[model samples]
Target: MKLALFADGHVGTQIADWLLQHYADDLCLVVTTQENSITEAAKQHDVPAVAFRSEQQVLDFAGTRSIAPDLGILAWWPQLIRQAFLDFPRHGFINTHPSLLPFNRGKHYNFWAIVEKAPFGVTLHMVEQGVDNGDIVAQRQIAYDWEDNGESLFHRAQSTMLDLFRETYPKIRSLQFARTPQDLSKGSFHHSSELEPASQVFLKQTYQAEELLNRLRARTFDEHPSCWFEADGTKYEVRINIRKADS
Candidate 1:
């Protein structure tokens, strides 16, 4: 598909790089929020592109492309896509969300899924005016383990997303894929601002040290593990570096 990619950070950069490397002939324009590492690399590859502070710039740039795309996919766009701006794609527009949709529908879902012990999956869906409210194209549920932490979950989910696009989006473009409206009742959305609070583990709630340790390992953040508070006037917190999955 000739694409005009609208995206946010690293995922946008990485996915654009993949498309640029594998399907350069089809990429129309790559639109991103700012010039970051991905944008730098995009320039190195000499890809057609635009970086802007607002979605309007992306919209205006897409207007300049005479050729249409077979499928337009949003990898990690932070901004919203207004209807007038998204109709540029002739086939349809699809998006890759970190969490499985109808559930974990918004940002910081990776950390939330780890904390909540929910499945870490990727959702590829049609783009709508609303947040992640679109027809489901494909989703792959990955089991979250006792040792699954925020950064680990993100890395694993990141790897799965491209595989998802390679496997699913192409089929949808070929019309061999089916479209199904999500069960609105089965899912929920969580915003980014709500996730800024840190997780605290209390020793008092623990039934066993091993179980508590297991759950503690499950909720570790990228920079640090969940801070633990003790009944005494001292704290016991762990900063996890290496991921030592149990053999």
Candidate 2:
């Protein structure tokens, strides 16, 4: 099985390591967002590694190959994968997205799930032209509590995503997984730019208590910028921590 891995971050590194160990001969190329562990592992094994900046680069590389890869895996990939690259992989690419597909299709899935009070989960799906609009290969719906802030949900989703990938590997290898086309109408889509505007707490505008809490908690990832409000000439960031009172 000739394979190409387009990956990033911890899950990406883990995938690369597993492939290098179990399917070294089958791996043709490793495409990473930057010089990370994925590239480093590929380097150690002398596998071809590239940080592709454009769709044309991927096309050119595929053109050089006599036979396209059997499959490609996109784990935590950042950019939108174009059709040219999608077509190069024989069985098409499978993406490990953090959100339950169709819903929260683009960026900030963790944050949106909380803000919108939508279904929160992880999905492994076939990569189509659109952002996370793909046939579902596998999915795991996660339930979040009021205690689940953006940071908690983010880590939880990542953990679940990796687990789903591991459990689904055998099916993927055998090409036995089902591709159920997502119902495009049922879920929501968001852009990366939408997050900032959504995160703005309007100081003057009245909001329901629940609505205000949801907005604050959704953006409450301590590692990143939190929800903010403008006061006079200055801006103030706010975050919340929810816990049950002990009896």
Candidate 3:
């Protein structure tokens, strides 16, 4: 039941802490980007941690340590793992994605889900070379009302993903689980650049209120770029604060 973990960012830190607390004995190595909270968290647990910038570095670290992990877990990792490293683990790899795959398969999935009106959810799947095109292990749909926005949806997906891991880890540990192949025809994948055009709002043109609102909500990640429009050579960023109406 030995495991290797690859992750970064806030969700990654939380997953790392959970692994340390619950599966300390089984964790063999942890990989994260350099100079981040996730790296610090792993070190605090006294786990063998490496900050890798590329796939080659990961291979080098494993070779140096003479470590062969039984399973590899990817939580909030931003890079594409090479097949050679994917094969290093005895049981291959599993990843957590913030949307119901084969929909919203790439970056900013939470934003794309709302904008496209796709099935909003989180997915745990077996990792293959294709981006998020993997066999599904488990998934759960998240509900959102009119009050929900990009920031709120992102947080909800993060929490649900963690919960899914907690619920499914036992079965994975025992190697007693089923894998469901995703129906590729049923959904779509978006590249990082695909989201660019959606981020721009045209103020001069008449747009449906719902469409305008969805765009505002989709692009409104905290500290990231906001939905914007240019009017009279002046650019304006849009933010929404929705509340339930009195019954």
Better of 1 and 2 by lDDT: 2
List, residue by residue over 145-221, the lDDT tens digit for candidate 2.
98889999899988898889888988887788999999999989988899999999887899999889998999998
CA RMSD of all predictions: 3.8, 1.7, 1.7
Residue 104 Cα positional deviation in candidate 3, in Å, after optimal superposition: 0.9
82: Cα error in model 2, Å: 1.3
Cα displacement (angstroms), candidate 1, residue 1, comes to: 4.2
Residue 123 alpha-carbon offset, candidate 2, angstroms: 0.4
lDDT on C-alpha atoms for all candidate structures: 0.71, 0.86, 0.86
Q: If scored against the real structure, what TM-score would every candidate get?
A: 0.77, 0.93, 0.93
Summing lDDT over every window of 10 consecutive residues in candidate 3, give the lowest-scoring window. Answer: 35-44
Tens-digit lDDT track of model 3 for 48-86: 788887877777888898888999989998888877778
Worst 10 residues of 1 by lDDT: 195-204
What shift in Å separates residue 122 of candidate 3 from its native position after superposition? 0.7
Off by over 4 Å in 2: 62-67
| lDDT tens digits, residue span 1-247, model 1 | 5666776666776777777777666667676777676566666666667786666656666567554666677888776778886676776688889888877787777766755556569888889888898998899987775556677788888888878877774575465777789987876778866553434665556456544454455556656546466557776765444455579
Better of 2 and 3 by lDDT: 2
Error of 1 at 210 (Å): 9.9
